[model samples]
Target chain A: MATIAVIDYGMGNLRSVGKALEHVDARSRILVTDDPATIRRADRVVLPGVGAIRECMAQLRRLELDAVIREVGSNKPFLGVCLGMQALLTTSEENGGMEALGMFPGEVRHFTACFAEAGVPTPGKVPHMGWNQVRQTRAHPLWRGIPDGSWFYFVHSYFVPLLDDAWTAGMTTYGLEFTAVIARENIIATQFHPEKSQTAGLALLANFTRWDGTA
Target chain B: MTLAKRIVPCLDVDQGRVVKGVKFVDIRDAGNPVEIAQRYDRAGADEITFLDITASSDGRETLVQVVEAVASEVFMPLTVGGGIRTPADIRRMLNAGADKVGINTAAIDNPDFVHQAAQRFGSQCIVVAIDAKRVSGADEPSRWEVFTHGGRRPTGIDAVSWAQRMAASGAGEILLTSMDRDGTREGFDISLTRAVSDAVPVPVIASGGVGCLQHLVEGVVGGGADAVLAASIFHFGEHTIAEAKAYMAAQGVVVRLAEDP
Candidate 1:
């Protein structure tokens, strides 16, 4: 049986994510924990987060889950959701420039701030609450059963501004194109909330459980 | 692509049991809130709102249990309203697995509560439920007035401006309910819905007075709301979430259709 560790640094809604994963595949033992040993032994890992990037980083470092995350994320199949996805990037403009895990070659930016920097109109809202369609840019295992233009639940103001497009697996448009999903080797992350996204979301979670982390 | 207009089913719970009444009077039991929420979730409801109608001392504990039970079964967003007064209340609900917390009476009492809650918990989790009644007089333009205490007392606050203020104060969404058409099932107050939807940058959920599937379509099309919420029609089995989505989709409104079971 594949054991999945949903990293719990006490920042996000870990309950819903764990429940959704269990609903997707009951046989897969899903454990929500911050214990380094348990996380290290898991076959697959899920990093779920919400709230400000500064506080998220604080909690992550305080629990020393940050180093464990980097180690597990590099070795096994890993998935990140929302702030967990953003935290993998180099830096975030949120809370006066906070440094992140520096795993991915990108920086997180506010919706309007990025638009203004790029000389474009403001997107719809700050948090980008509710559901929006995710357009797949490149084929991957996570997109195996999910449709190309499936709507996923999104709730965030800041998004990853990809410095390297090679990692971009999916892109979505609000006022401008934003990185929706990024994957490379053994890692996959999405800005949208697959757990809250209904059918397509459940399908994606199912795919993740079955994924071997190949391109 | 345009975001799909959501059809949310609301459950008014009193001591762990789902109940419905006319304007908060003559209440009768409906079913278990957790069971009803799970049924709606399986039926393809976009979201579920569990409102603790009787937010009594022990009712909080029951509501927490209902939320936990429902959250384990349901996979979509859950918004809990009624008796959420402070940041701690909001924290308790979120910890109980609620995606959003709706503040009405307490919000009116302290406008700063909206700001504080939004700041503490990201704005995406803060929802301000505004109960409004259309006020007509020579002194002011034909506008809706904000009502608190389940629409029994009027606050004299303009609905449109109050919504804008709430949004500015960091409210991620607004749950606007029309007191006049709440239980009448006539239809959603489109004008009122439109006024608030247009006034705010955040998403607005048009609630109250959902009689038929057509009313739901109108709530999205005519009212320009991001989502439409109904209770009695769905509770009474007049329509299912799939039925409402089909009607809205046929009317050229983008709604998430249920996949084949």
Candidate 2:
């Protein structure tokens, strides 16, 4: 029995993520837990969160789940979503800058900069809250069933700007193209909420259940 | 390539029963809220909204169960509205697996509550629903005012200005509903929708008054709405969501087809 643990660090929509996992695969045991021991013991670990990055980091550090996340994230199959995706990076421009888990060499930035950098024409809304097309830049197992330009539900102000092309798995454009999906080694993360997205999202969850964290 | 215009189905659920469309449309057993939600999901509704028009407190709890039941099997974004007063109310809806909560009368009563809720639980989840009535006469300048109590009473607040204020206060999206066109099913008040959509940078979802698929297309093209919401047209089996999208796509509106990813 593959016990998949959804890490609850006092942030993110755990119910949807947990239920989405159960909806995709009923055979696997899904546990939405804050217990580090259970997370470490699970075959696959999912880190999902929402809200501000500063508060997210504060809660993670206060609960002392940061170190455990670092450990499990290295050896096991790790999935980061939304704020959890930003938390995995080195630093974030949110809340006057904050240091993060540093599992990856990247920084999170707000939509203000992206909009300003694009200059004038305001690509879209601040919180890109809708179904937008995500073009897959590279092929991966999670992208196996989902099409290249599948529409995913996104509602966020901050995003990880594309730095290294190798790390980018999927890219989406609002006014400018930004990193929508990032992956390296056994880790995968998405700015869009797969659990909330309709069919393609369910397919991603179903794919994740069967994925062994390989490229 | 672009952020497609969303077609959302709004269901006014009461005591776990879908109550709104039944009153107007001659539908067969329109009580199953989850089944309707699932059908909408199948037809490619970008999101599903359940307006909790429950009069009693116990009925409010039933709305949560309806949301939970639909969310369990159907994988789509859900927004819940009606009688959400405090932080506890907001928390209850979000905990029930609702992706967003629509705050209308409460925001009008206390605009600060919108700010507080957004600050506490990011602006992404907070949506301010505006019920607007055309206050300006035919000869006068085009203007709309905010209305409360199902458009029976007027708050005398400017709808466009209120939408700007709510967006400034941290509302991620604005759900603009036209009271005059609401049950009429003529079409969306395009001028009113354009006013709010231009006033605020946040996405505006045009609601109330969608008789045909062309009305949906007009809601996006003329109204400049990010998304369009309707009840009778879809619930009464007039047209499926897929047909609406196809019509919109044919009208040169960029929409996510049910066939595409």
lDDT of each: 0.87, 0.88
Give the 10-residue window scoring lowest on summed lDDT in candidate 2 chain A.
A7-16
Mind giving the per-residue lDDT tens digits that candidate 2 earns over B109-176?
99999999988778888999999999998999999999998888999999999999999999999999
**Candidate 1 C-alpha lDDT tens digits along B1-261:** 746678898899899899987778878888988779878878888889988887677988889888888888888889999889888788888878888999998888999999988777778888999999999775866699999888889898999999999999989899999998988889999999999988898889999898899999888888888899998889988888888888888889887777521
Q: List the residue pairs that clash in candidate 1.
A: none
lDDT of 1 by residue, A53-146 (tens): 8888998899998999999888999999999999999899998999999999668999877767777654465667777788888899999877
CAPRI classification of candidate 2? medium
The reply for model 2, stretches above 4 Å from the true place, is: A120-122, B21-29
Best by lDDT: 2
* TM-scores vs. true structure, each candidate: 0.93, 0.97
Runs of candidate 1 exceeding 4 Å displacement: A114-123, B138-140, B259-261
